[model samples]
Target: MSADKPKPAGVKIVDAAKKELMNVSAIERDGNFLVVKGKIFGTMPMTAKLSPEEARKALRMLSPGLVWFLLTFPFRRSPEPPAR
Candidate 1:
């Protein structure tokens, strides 16, 4: 590690699957890995397991605001159901 880049501190493993799925810069040491991630909007941290090609394809499928709108759309509905 260089002075410009600091090392990550190791925390006890929670769940291996959870750890793997987390969005973090990870380091492997002594047969274990430590991951550091940030929470987005108090929700679960978002992680990308997709390859670059897959990610690019996904990004091209939606407009910038479309994803956000779809995610938030369910919450913007009326309290009562619409009559047919």
Candidate 2:
């Protein structure tokens, strides 16, 4: 990695203590791969390409958590509005 070249968003570390959050802007299919475009910490642009197998694995891992969230979503209270 050269100093002049910017690091890839996935590997870049902004703050060690703070948790990094990726805000996915778009997901596009490029041929046989899936291209994920997002911003890390809501600022740095990131792009990731995943093969079919990788996408399936990611789906399998995320499905359970997504299902659980959907099942309990109605019961969960919304966050309190910020004071003016």
Candidate 3:
């Protein structure tokens, strides 16, 4: 019970998840957990409970630009040398 002690996680991940998810409902918060209830690949109802750290990691992984960058990185040619 100290000011320096961190408070238990709340809904911080909801926003991040929504931004990353973009197409589904992912804004439910339960205690220190984020509950994302929705369909996946139009297959079935996928309900995932994620902690704050997990959510942040997922956000990074789910980034469209990041995914494309990683996919195309190997094929991208390096820049040419500057003119003398």
Give lDDT: candidate 3, residue 22.
Answer: 25
lDDT of 2 by residue, 1-84 (tens): 657866344433345444667767677899999898889887888899999998688777767879799899889995675799
lDDT of 3 by residue, 16-82 (tens): 3343222354558899997876655444556788899987888776678898898998899966757
- In model 2, which runs have C-alpha deviations exceeding 4 angstroms? 1-20, 59-84
Whole-structure CA lDDT of model 3? 0.64
The candidate maximizing lDDT is 2
Candidate 2 at residue 47, lDDT? 91
Model 3 lowest lDDT segment of ten? 11-20
Q: Where does candidate 3 clash, by residue pair?
A: none
Deviation in Å, model 1, residue 10 alpha carbon: 31
lDDT of the candidates, in the order given: 0.51, 0.75, 0.64
Q: Candidate 3: misplaced stretches above 4 Å?
A: 1-23, 56-84
TM-score of each: 0.26, 0.46, 0.35
Total clashing residue pairs per candidate? 0, 0, 0
